[model samples]
Target: MKLFKSNEWQRVKKSKAMVIALAVIALIPSLYAVIFLSSLWDTYGHVSNLPVAVVNQDQTATVNGKTENLGQNLTTSLVNGQDWKFTQVSEKTARSGLKSGKYYMTVTIPSDFTKSSGTLLGKSPKTPTIDIQQNGGRSFFAEKITDAAAEKLKNKVSQSLQKVYLENLLKGTKTSQDGFTKAAKGVSQLGTALGKVQTGAGQLQTGTMTLQTGATTLSNGLLQYTGAMGKLTNGSANLVTGNTQLAASLQKIGTGISQGQAANAANISKLNAGFDKVNQGLQQLSQMQVTIDQSQLNSSAASVSSGLSSVDQNVTAVLADPTVQEKMKTDPAFAQQVSDLKSNLTATEKSSQDLKTSSAALNTAVMQQISGLKTQLTTLSTQAITLNNSAKTAIQQLNDSLSQVANVLATQAAPGATNLAQGATTLTNGLGQLNGQSQTLNGGATALSTGTSQLVAAENQLTMALQATQNGSDQLAQSLANGAVKLSVVHTGTKNVQALTNPVKNKSTSLSTIANNGTGMAPYMMSVGLFVGMISFSTAFDFITLGKKPKSGMHWWAEKQTVMATVWSAQAVIMTGLLVLVDSMAPKHILMTFVVALVTAFAFNQFVTMVIVALGKMGSALLLVFMVLQLSASAGTYPIELSNSFFQVIHPFMPMTYSVDAFRQVISIGGLAINDLLVLLALGLVSMVLTWLMYHRKLQADTVLFPKTAEK
Candidate 1:
């Protein structure tokens, strides 16, 4: 170990290349470890304690019906730092705060939030609709924290709704209990009320039945009473006539009796007068009795003998006349019997006269009533007929209006039918046109395809014909060459004899022809020789590393440095050559070209070597970064300021990036001259110095970091 260490230190100190290689290798792993796994907090430091603003527009809903506003219950109950932080502000303020970056994001609970409480059985309810406005783009940790808070707010709202739902259900149990008690009380009261009501209803029904029967009986009685009044009226006419006859007879007989007494002629006249008077008085008395007809009046048709009160009395006492009185006076037994008969007749006649007076008054009242009822009934009947006619006329007018409306509707239907027919025809024509167009298009496409095929075949045939023509031309030229050779020999033989005239001219002419041919052939051979030289250069480049020992870090380092220098130098030449070759071979400043090439190559080598050193031979993936970032990107062809951001980012680090810019400068300035080379050189030099330092650090490590897990 001691001898090996001495030799290794001697070899390292003797070679600048070995020291650099060992140093770079030793530092690389530590840099990676320090970069990747240094701190847990730094990775997540940007996300902690992000601030957000939550504005709740809804005020808490009152338990009672009256209050300032219905609030967001969740917002009201939200525990700050636990559920959410509520920053009280107007919507504009919240928005302003978020925009000014005082807060990362702003959330607002909307109105109409009670709907969030509604849910299925035992499930958590959803949160109310809320607006979460983010000021910055979503990439920031502030936005992420805002999102986390919003989700927590949603979950807490659901939890609150769950609590409220359960509370409501629990309250319902008490409500149900109260409801059951009230229902039971109501049921008992209803039963008692129903029983009383049933009793009352039964009583009412019985009373109604009784009243119906009474009404029927009263109706029959009213009808009978009407008929009795009519009968009384009819009987009054007959009684009137009888009374009138009695009155006339009483008047005549009274006058005749007076004449008979004056002349002392006959007692029969007095008797007749007295008998008629008695009859008339009896008729008057009959009016007082309660017969079915009371319309027969005593005063209305009574025959009163045209005498005073005494005469009426006398007539009443006609049954007690003197002849009867004398007979009663002559015999006691006979007189007693006659007096009793007279008393009985007098009472009966008096009773009949009183009844006649009452009947007259009643009949007058009944007739008046009957006349009023008949008038009312006739008026009602006329009104009913008039109402019937009016109703029929109104019905006829209504029917006429309805018929007119129906006719109008039926007549207007023709336009709709015509429109429908036109629409159908238009639709059919459109469909037909579409089908025709489709067919035409299909045929056109097929013809286009055929044309394309013919065109392709024609082009192929033309190519083959041109190729065959070229081959035939080559053959013709060869045959012409052989013919020329033979002609030359024959001409030389022929000119040998004519040497005196033409030998000197032919010699000069042949020398000129030979010189021109040599000039043409010389260019072709030189081109081939240059190509062969390019191949040899490539072969030398491939095997150059074989001359150096792998064990000697200096050999490896020197090879790498030489390779880097040559690559940069060659890249500069080729880049300039490419410009000269592909384009006008424009004037270039070779110094500026070399400087740009060196800067670009150094930067590129560092980056490429970094990748290769990191991934070994598998660093082919780095080419993807090159092609996409350099060639396809504007960093190679145009100014980075004109390119997109991604191109601008890597432009300073890419070789073509500086090469392209320097190429433009060299071409524009007309020579190998540029002051901007300082900036480019500084970037490359700084990057190279850092890379060298990194390599020096890597040399201190005992072993390679990758693919060498075992220490031994």
Candidate 2:
């Protein structure tokens, strides 16, 4: 304290130059802090002063039948934004303004802007662009500010376009919903029709079974008729033989006139019995023909064929449905299902064709059998009648001939024998024709049986296919109903569309809120000013030159400490006070800010003093270099991580880095950085100790070199 009063205050009190120099040193920090902070007080807020040009050449376009001038709307929005000085100008003027530095950026809206925007809803859409040209050669910060404004303008235009697009999309969605509703109703009706078709398929399947049963019955009947014909054929052969023998016997009797009348009468009675048996067989055949109905069978087959055709048509309709086709494209499983259904329908169609062919053939064969049987019955009946009449005539002739046997034998007996032989030959021929027809009928019956069996198999397959088709239709109806419900449930209101347009929103909260550029930058500026103040003081004041011979190096250190502490404290007060008063910096912890500033000033003073005291002018030059490095490394404007690796590596070592952080914590809403304050204090104490050690070494060297000066 004695050293400070005697050595520092006496010099300042004695000379006006010394007092003015000390005053200038005290106020230097304030000048620097206030001047820099005030200049950057609100850089972004004053961006409206920066000139930018807007060239709107876009014409009108139609969107959804409504005329829109997107370019004009964007121009109006930019003019009203107040973020930038957006001047409406021609393209040539905008370009010249950019070249002449009259504008930092020029935004050009081409004539096709609105047209391209309108194309968003078209099949071939065009992208709308807003051309932004920036003049970076002008003030970099001004160019950067305008660049930001341009980006914001782009965003505003995009939002507007998006809002219109979303509105149109919602309208289109509503239209689609209406169309889907109608389609759903149509699909429901189709489902009902398909249900009826399914019913018909079942009935047709039953009819097929009935037809198959009838075919089996007809086949069995044909087999029985064929066996009967065989028996009849054998009997006809025997009758022919018997009749020939009877005719020969009659001839012999005619020749032998002594033959008895009883024998002739007996042979005539046997012929009468044979004719009655033949007539009975023909009656049985006629009765069998009456039981089988041809028309009914043909009608059932036609009905089944028609039902199969309807089913095929319905299947085709389902496959052709747009909803099903869309599903087929997206869903592999659904595609496979449709493919299987198509295969089943194809098989059902083939079966229907086969059944129709078989039915026609069966009908033809039955008709032939019935007609042939009828004709054969008619011929056989006529022949039987003639034969019966001949037998009775022969009986009457025999009775008449009982009186004249030789003449009766010579005339009527021989003629009766010849007539019997002719009747027998005709009967045999008819039986042979019947037998040949029976074989043909048997073949038809066999074919009909095979076809009916196949038809039954096909009917079962078709029934399964129909069942699958019914299931698919039901699913389709349900899907359409679901889709319609979903479409109805969607909300396409203005608020919802807006929400969709900007799906993500930013919600930010700051732990330490900086009011503006000035407030945020105040800490760095204050720290730099205080550092420069210390450097200035170090350059101006003589810290190493002793005013008097001291008892020890500690005494020299104490004197310089008092002078430095007093001056640094005054600089800290002035700088901090000016930040609050001039720059309007309202720190959260005002007292803490003052305390941090004072400590930072002291830390800087000690560091400067230590280096200057140890190395004199060269140390001052080194501190200047250090201050420059600290400016970049201190993370004042940007984070220390954003700096180069060298700066980042040395950032922790820089006293200003801690000082800036400490100032921010106290100035902003963040809590005080106790660790930073401690670090600053530690740096100051270490520098002070280092200065003391250097002073101690110098005193030792001086004492050795100059014993008389040291002793004084």
Q: What is the C-alpha lDDT of each candidate?
A: 0.40, 0.69
Q: Model 1, range 622-642, lDDT digits (tens) per residue?
A: 544554555534343334688
**lDDT of each residue in 602-680, candidate 2, tens digit only:** 8888888888987889998998898899899999889987878999899998888899899989889667889999999
Candidate 1 lDDT (Cα, 0 to 1)? 0.40
Error of 2 at 576 (Å): 0.7
Candidate 1 Cα outliers beyond 4 Å, as residue runs: 1-48, 59-79, 82-93, 100-102, 110-128, 135-145, 192-712
- TM-score of candidate 2 to 2 decimals: 0.66
Regions more than 4 Å wrong, model 2: 1-7, 121-123, 170-187, 191-472, 478-490, 544-548, 557-563, 693-712
Clashing pairs in 2: none
* Estimated TM-score for each candidate: 0.27, 0.66
* Model 2 CA lDDT for position 377: 45
Candidate no. 1 TM-score: 0.27
